[model samples]
Target: MSLQVRIMTPDRIFLNEEAEEIILPTNTGQMGVLKNHAPLITALDIGVMLIRSKNEWTPLALMGGFALVKQNQVTVLVNEAESAETIDPNEVENSFTIAKTKLEQAEGQKQKVEANFVFKRERARYQVIKQAKKM
Candidate 1:
């Protein structure tokens, strides 16, 4: 059996994937979902969600949001989402570096915001890059 996943953002719908299993990036940590798992609605961490289909795994980066799971269907509504094909290693690395620098020099609320964004983006980079290597 499989499940339904719809990943959306303010700009557009990033994905509507169907798979045998899903690995979510929860704020607490990673959580795995399979058919008939308990119903849940939980926060999504800034990381990656791996989709398993036909014995193949597809990985995509995700930002904070919420996921609603009931029965065997999971709707992933995220703040931001990106596929491996869409991520640029150089760009992600630069963003991570800039965020780190801002954190070090952070002195105000604005700096804190920048630092948070950096952390979120860097987490995506790490997840996607690791998936790329495995594939």
Candidate 2:
């Protein structure tokens, strides 16, 4: 048996299919879900979500939201999502470098917070592409 996975954003449904395994980037940490997993809800973080189907892994950049796992069904609703296939690796790499520099140079608390968020987002996107290439 496989888990029904549906990932959605405000603009559209990003994915709707079956997955053998799912690795979610939750606020607490990474959570793995499989068939017959217990029902629960979790707040996601800006990170990479890895979905495995048919022995192949696909990575996606999730921009924070919520996820529900119930009866072998996983529903992910995120503020934004970017697929590895759609992202430009070169652009993401450059943005990630810039974000890291900005975060390091940030002065005030507010600047640090904003810069940190951008750094995380760009890092997530970069990781997704890297993971996809490996798999």
Candidate 3:
């Protein structure tokens, strides 16, 4: 049997399907989930989430949130999520470059934190697009 995966944002449900495997970017690190995996909860980071179904991998840019895995069901609730197909590579590349610059030039602690957050978010999007192109 496959795992039931559901990804949601505040506005709407991003994905509701079955995936053979899932790799989540958690606060600790990357965590892999599969069918019949033990129940657990994890805090997601601003990074890429990979879902594998039918031996094909799909990537999604996921913002910070929490995930719950129980009884072969994986539920992800994030602040924002974007599929690679919906993102523009050119726009993401430009934003990633700008965010990197801002992060490097940030002075105060608050500015540094904010810049870092933006940088990570853009970087995640950039990574998702890059991964998609490779597939």
Task: Report the C-alpha lDDT of model 1 over 55-112, residue by residue, as the tens digit.
Answer: 9898888878999999788988887888878888778777777777777788899878
Q: Give lDDT for model 3.
A: 0.97
lDDT of 3 by residue, 84-135 (tens): 8889988999999999999999999999999999999999999999999998
Q: Give each model's whole-structure lDDT.
A: 0.84, 0.96, 0.97
Lowest summed-lDDT stretch of 10 residues in model 3? Answer: 81-90
lDDT at residue 91 of model 1 (Cα atoms): 80
Residue 24, model 3: lDDT of 99
- Consecutive 10-residue window with the lowest summed lDDT within model 2: 126-135
Q: Among all windows of ten consecutive residues in candidate 1, which has the lowest summed lDDT?
A: 121-130
Candidate 3 Cα outliers beyond 4 Å, as residue runs: none
What TM-score do all the candidates reach, one by one? Answer: 0.86, 0.98, 0.99
lDDT of 2 by residue, 11-124 (tens): 999999999999999999999999999999999999999999999999999999999999999999999999988899889999999999999999999999999999999999
